[model samples]
Target: MDEEDSQIQKTQLAMTVPTTRVDVLVIGAGQAGLATGYRLAQEGVSFLIVDENQQIGDSWRKRYDSLTLFTPRSLNALPGKVLDGDPDGYPSRDEFADYLANYALHYNLPVQTNFRIASLDIEAEALFWAEGADGSAILARAVVVATGGFQVPVIPEIAGTFSPQVRQLTPETYKGPADVEHGPVVVVGDGASGRDIAFELSAFKSVILSRGRNRRLLPEKLFGISMWKWLKVLGLLRAGPNSPLGRAMRKSDPFPSRERSDRDLEKRGVVLASRLIGANGKRAVFADGSTLDVGAVIWCVGYHDDFTWLMIKAAKDQTGSIVVKDGRSPVPGLFFIGRPWQRNRASALVTGSTADAQRLVDDVEQYLSSTRQGEGSIALVAK
Candidate 1:
């Protein structure tokens, strides 16, 4: 090889070295984790962000190639950087990843790629440990679990007698229409992913599925007002559970536009079914007392929150969500951002986490200062 080409390869090898320890540790290098890192960097605090992916943007890049954000580009951006594409259009999956990578580089955030956090343990002090691709263990102080809701895919257990001829796949494992074997496809679940997948696949084959009958779809805009604008104006999106709008939102699915209408799917030759009861080879039973034969089944059922690796017993509820009251958790030094109804309507959105991150930053400063002053010390410890 030429000398210049050999030197370039050597420089690439120099960048992959890993290190341990930081003042703060953020896990899951997706939107939330990266945002937290950016804010911490701005504050000049020593911190490190890590992810399980071998390369940056692996999370977004692994999704189906045709996937696009439901939210407009204007609403989806990392801290300090706006998406470079059309502001009016929903960005493709790759474009979103490009934005994130740019955000990390612009801030010069110290992110250790390919490092996967294995577990967190807290005794008198918090201990964070992770396993890297090279089989090295890295440790840190404060830990922010930004793993988000998409890690685990939940597939329901249905009684069955299958001939082993029918194939099944989850949205996580789905790559494209080319991945499925030839024949009719049955997609289970009526959530956003299910509908989008079914719609995309309907063009190629006759599809069938089940759904909630009374589900409502909210237009991104009503009249000339963006739905986001209305949510903010009507005070519906950010209202607390005690507030009328917040109460209504909590009871309603946020992305109602995702589910296809019965007539809409029927126009595409997709059959809407009630439920899956049991299976017999290619034939399946439904809750409405129906049977059908299909070549493939795609289960798009929602996920369950699993925090078994985290030792924060007091912070989580039975469902593994951090219980918040007035934007504060029960555990000290523990704050949750990007969770449903954590603060305002934007709590769960990519852009909305900035507010939550700022609040948590302020809280962290106050906590450290108070501890240094010996005011927050337990009375029993004095003995």
Candidate 2:
């Protein structure tokens, strides 16, 4: 998922603030946001793309340095831009970040970076008002929250019970073995990230991967063909979440690691421990009642859905995730993209955003037109 942290204190100011008017306002200039912007530009919409990061693709760069996408370059490209490299080879996090930067530049898209939106609301005037910390605001007819669901790092509540001396790290903060302290490292959550971290740290520290359940390790290739190619040809990627085939996939969304497994980690000297249940001082207790000493712990437990910034109370569900059909939320003129299974299985992948963006922009266009809104215009209003 395209990830970043934009959960901050909401700036409760009036729409009277020096506001920038736009036809469509897209937040988070990540893959999903950029794709949405591209589609909006193609439709001749007066839109703006804003991101909290200093650059267009810092979201990918801010991730772990060892991060390499599971999808090859062939499947990772955004719409109209081919990722330049060995089509079958995976791109490192840095390489993908640079590609996103170049994609924005080549398209000459209007992107505003280092612009953090603290709060958003839809007023009775039929305009979306977004306030920033620096006293700037955006008033738009429609808002596309392209930021994915992965906004806040989610750790178990049991973490607070651990001793203060045990240093903790999330994938957001963890870079490499250098970040780990002396002694064994206990990695919580045996997902792809957890496995990758444990496998990498095994060479330096006595690494333990807490496996929640047995993960299926499909080979990277089948019949001498890349598994992705197989998936595409099998029509698995086109299945929507509501489809019979897609409903089956919703059971487990993580793309099973093709390379790493308990056997692979065991051979790499990684201890395959049971699910982590508790932690006390320097020892991490597992579900099997086994405890192992640890110096540092990494939580690859995943992220929380944080949309508290969107001040539309009725539009949010009990879980705080926006209630949306496809990308359109319960409220008119407010839409979301980049959510897994939002439209289909590929919705989680970067390339998947292209189709979703196109459709969502179409919906946005329809919403704007049906509302009898005039063409986008700019004006200098009194602050």
Q: How does candidate 2 score on lDDT?
A: 0.82
lDDT by residue (87-159, candidate 2, tens digit) is 8888999999998999999999989899888888775567787888677888788899988877878988878
Query: Relative to the true structure, how large is the alpha-carbon lDDT of every model?
Result: 0.68, 0.82
Task: Report the number of backbone clashes for model 1.
Answer: 0
Candidate 1 structure quality by residue, lDDT tens digits, 1-383: 85467445434533454436555667778887888887877776667778888767888888877888777777787768888776757788888888788788888888778776554544234433333556444444455667665667776676246446777878778888987775678788877678888888999877887664345667657885566556656766556655777666666666536336556777777888887868888887788888888888888877666666665567778877656664455766555555656676567667566767777666655654554454332211100
**Alpha-carbon RMSD to native, per candidate:** 9.8, 5.2
Candidate 2, run of 10 with poorest lDDT: 1-10
TM-score of 1: 0.82
Residue pairs clashing in model 1 are: none
- For residue 140, model 1's alpha carbon misses the true position, in angstroms, by 3.8
Error of 1 at 220 (Å): 3.8
